[model samples]
Target: MRCLIAEDHLLSRRVLKELLSPDFDCDIAVNGREAIDSFVLAHEAKRPYDVILMDIMMPEIDGMEALKSVRSLEKKMQIPSHLAVKVIMITALGDPHTVIKSFNECEADSFIVKPLTRHKLATELRKLNVLK
Candidate 1:
């Protein structure tokens, strides 16, 4: 699958890439704006990303905002229902309120904590049915 990773931290991005490389074709975005731009460009190119791993905190346009933007764009563009990309939010914050908000209000497909282990990531991917 084609995946996009939106993360500001270099080490986190690198670790995710290393962990998921065997299972997917991945693209990296340093910030939320770039993530949105890359997603749009990829979709326009007929190579839409299957999933996106988004970091909550970012320099330009936070992940939640970016998620809303992406959803809006998908609606505006009339993208097919089946072609909608899934977004999984990743962060170090473990606030229950934020997690609840992310699930109910932000409409994230899933949430993953930072400093992830390969086993945990794999399990999460399996839960999403993104892993074989």
Candidate 2:
């Protein structure tokens, strides 16, 4: 699988890369704007990511905004819902409101609360059927 990890923290990004790179082709973006650019570039290149791990609190644009943009882009491109990139919100915020917003408004495929663990990530991916 191809994955984009959008995280502002250096250590978190590094750890996520390490965990995912073993099984996926992983790319890193430090913030939401960069994540959007990378996503667009990949799509334009016909090499769209299969999954995105987006951090909710980033400089410039936030993950919620980025997720909306990504879904909009997919809609604009007329990509079928099944073919749309799966987005998993990665956030330190564990509040019910944020979680509800992620799923209800942003329409994330899944979520992982920080501090992220390999098992938790794998479980979410499994729920999405991104992993066996």
Alpha carbon lDDT of each predicted model: 0.87, 0.93
Candidate 2 ranges with C-alpha deviation above 4 Å: none
How do the residues 1-132 of candidate 1 rate in per-residue lDDT, one tens digit apiece? 999999999999999999889889999999999999998999889998888999999998999888888888998999875667878899988799878877777778889887788987787778777887
TM-score of 2: 0.98
Instruction: Tell how far residue 132 is off in model 1, in angstroms.
Output: 0.9
Ten contiguous residues with the weakest lDDT in model 1:
79-88
CA shift of 98, model 2, Å: 0.1
Clashes of each: 0, 0
Clashing pairs for predicted structure model 1, backbone only: none
Q: Candidate 1, TM-score vs. the true structure?
A: 0.93
11-48, model 2: which lDDT tens digit per residue?
A: 99999999898789999999999999999999999899
User: RMSD to native for every prediction?
Assistant: 1.3, 0.7
